[model samples]
Target: MRITTKGQVTIPEEIREAAGFGPGTEVDFVIGDDGLVRVIPSDRLRGERAASLQGAISRLRGSADVALPTDEIMALTRE
Candidate 1:
């Protein structure tokens, strides 16, 4: 996939599913010694259990109080 005119690129669905990436998911890029960049789920990196991917997704659902509307969330992904 190509980056848009705004330098935005869509993550593949399978990668998103595998990485527990949903709207509002916080991610950081990890450049390894292998010269590959990995998109890491910030929650897991922050000491949240690696098996608790759903927990991160659920938090984005407003369980903790600050849920954004779908359009607003999608707009962020484009940026």
Candidate 2:
């Protein structure tokens, strides 16, 4: 199938059905390490976002040196 000037290509009905891509389904395009592109549905997007957030939390887990309480932190921020 040809992509239009808008970079849009229609996926075949059979493939769409197999992939559970019904009308109005939210999708994301992912490029793999093997240089292959994949169409991922939104249901999987939540897991991906959670994993990314977990990674960030892990990286910042012990980076905070200050032990200020919530009110003190808020006061510092206001100053």
Candidate 3:
């Protein structure tokens, strides 16, 4: 396959389908010392679905008996 002047090449349809590449799917490019390039799916970085943190801190609400320093509490609140 040849890269056009725009630095783009049409990935063969068969290869794309077999690799499950699709619109909006993220991929990575790795270059070996031998000048070989490989395409890998980004999902490999995430082992599994992640849990939502929306309610993870719900338990901390109204649980503080002692007051913390304003600066320290503000730092934690930012996250």
Error of 3 at 15 (Å): 0.0
Name the Cα RMSD for model 2.
2.5
* Tens-digit per-residue lDDT, 1-79, candidate 1: 9979997789999989987899999887789899998889886566656547777787677554668899988898999
lDDT of 3: 0.77
Off by over 4 Å in 3: 45-79
Q: Highest TM-score among the candidates is held by which one?
A: 2
| Backbone clashes under 3 angstroms, per model | 0, 0, 0
Candidate 3 has its poorest 10 consecutive residues by lDDT at 45-54
Give TM per candidate. 0.50, 0.69, 0.49
| Model 3 lDDT tens row, 1-79 | 9999998888898999999999887877778799999887877534322333435567667888988899999999998
Q: Which stretches of candidate 2 lie over 4 Å from their true place?
A: 58-66
| Model 1: lDDT of residue 30 | 80
lDDT for 36 (candidate 3): 98
Question: What clash pairs does model 2 have?
Answer: none
